[model samples]
Target: MPSVGIEGPVVSRGLDGDGAVEAPPFGNANEIGWYRGGARPGAAGVAVFVGHMDTRAKPAVFYRLGDVRPGEEVTVTRADGRTAVFTVERVETVAKDDFDAQRVYGQHKRGRAEIRLLTCGGAYEPEERSYTGNLVVSGYLTRTGTG
Candidate 1:
């Protein structure tokens, strides 16, 4: 697996009652969550993973997610013991109010496999206990291996 330089393993997380995938708990700052309804990491569609940038006490697993540059590698190990290697295409921080759902979650390429790593970013709003924007790292499948 491509080393992401983070702590903890990714766990499967399903959508909430509102049909939205929940992020990993802030208390468990090292864990990442994969959206169960999305495509598999190396499948022919976009797969999504979400995490927390930071908690009240410290930085989380994806705290440096925004630092990922184009061409960097991200590796995900599936339950079947296969690893999907993805190359970062780009990274952006979008305001929550102006988030483009289509670009963030829609299928961009017809048959290529893609992945999006998401986390809270921008200014923290203490009153709302949230951030004003989201940090998204977009990547595409580049290779695979047995893990």
Candidate 2:
């Protein structure tokens, strides 16, 4: 997983659940802590990153995740000192209550590495309510390096 200090920035890792890491507030917008996963940034597999869009009273780090657009470039810097660049292929918003975690977090057959940035989405519920769904930014690995 990726590590961050008080000045921590967003990064990526494997979903294997071995590394001790933290995902800084999305876009450096807040202080909420999230997990960046365990997969090596550029490795051939799915790299999952999860964060809260908002808490009970305050907006969480990933509130603006839905703003990501297709064809946009996403960079995943690995703890091993390698950085991977991915091109966003698709962006989907799924209801938080209706999302199938297995299909969303499950494995993929693509040869290139894929990363999913997830957070809450849709209209916020007022009573017996919470986030309506999730905003997902899916991208395919395009490049990797230190710089």
Candidate 3:
């Protein structure tokens, strides 16, 4: 996402044994974790990516995610040698307690190749060492090309 000042490796990640989506390891704070269990970037379904907004020491790869706005473009380079260009549809900040997995990760419409970028946001809880909400950026595929 060079358009928004985000540049990093995209690591394929899977669910944990408890079925929870895992973030990139602490060692890879600059990496973006792509959910391998969902639709591919250009596929007709929702694809999700997660990254840390900031580490304990400094701002991470997605620190500027919330800076993005609607109508901007997000480009994804797939491992399969293809490029997916998506246009931002919306951006939201949902409280942790109000985080709806289905609504955030679910497909907005049948056969639409959508993508979501998630990161921690809202009030930071120093006691818990985590934020009170998550920032979600929604987009839909607008173009595709061979890499």
Candidate 4:
């Protein structure tokens, strides 16, 4: 996603025992994690991508994810050599405590291939050492090409 200065291989990930998606190891901060249990990119459902905003010492692959704006494009080059381009529809900062999992990760359209780029955002709470919310960028497939 050049629009947000993101470029890296997506490692397949799955849900943990508690049913929450697993994140890439902190050591691999430069890589993005894809929820493999869900719809594949360019398929007719929501595809999720997660990455870290920053590592302990420096910014990570999705450090600039929140900078992406509506109307901008996010391109995903699939492992099968096809490319799917999506147009940014909305960028939201959803509070962690108030997050709606279905709303944020649900398909936007019945037959459209959509995606959500997610990373931590909002004010940092020192006591918890965690962000207050998450940055969610929702987009739908707009173009496809064989790369």
For candidate 1, write residues 36-90 as lDDT tens digits: 8889889999999998888888888898887788999988888899999999888
CA shift at 131, candidate 4, in angstroms? 0.3
**What lDDT does candidate 3 reach at residue 125?**
98
lDDT of 4 by residue, 29-120 (tens): 99999999988898999999998888778888889998899999999989999999999999999999899999999987788899998899
Off by over 4 Å in 4: none
Sequence-dependent TM-score of model 1: 0.92
Which pairs of residues collide in candidate 1? none
Model 3 agreement with the true structure over 64-112: per-residue lDDT tens digits: 9999999999999999889999999989999989988999898888899
- Residue 33, candidate 4: Cα error in Å is 0.6
Q: Each candidate: what lDDT? A: 0.86, 0.63, 0.92, 0.90
Ranked by TM-score, the better of candidates 1 and 3 is 3
- Ranked by lDDT, the better of candidates 2 and 3 is 3
Between which residue pairs do clashes occur in model 3?
Answer: none
**Clash count list over all predictions:** 0, 8, 0, 0
lDDT of 2 by residue, 66-143 (tens): 667888777765667687887877788887667787677554555768887776677877895666777777788877
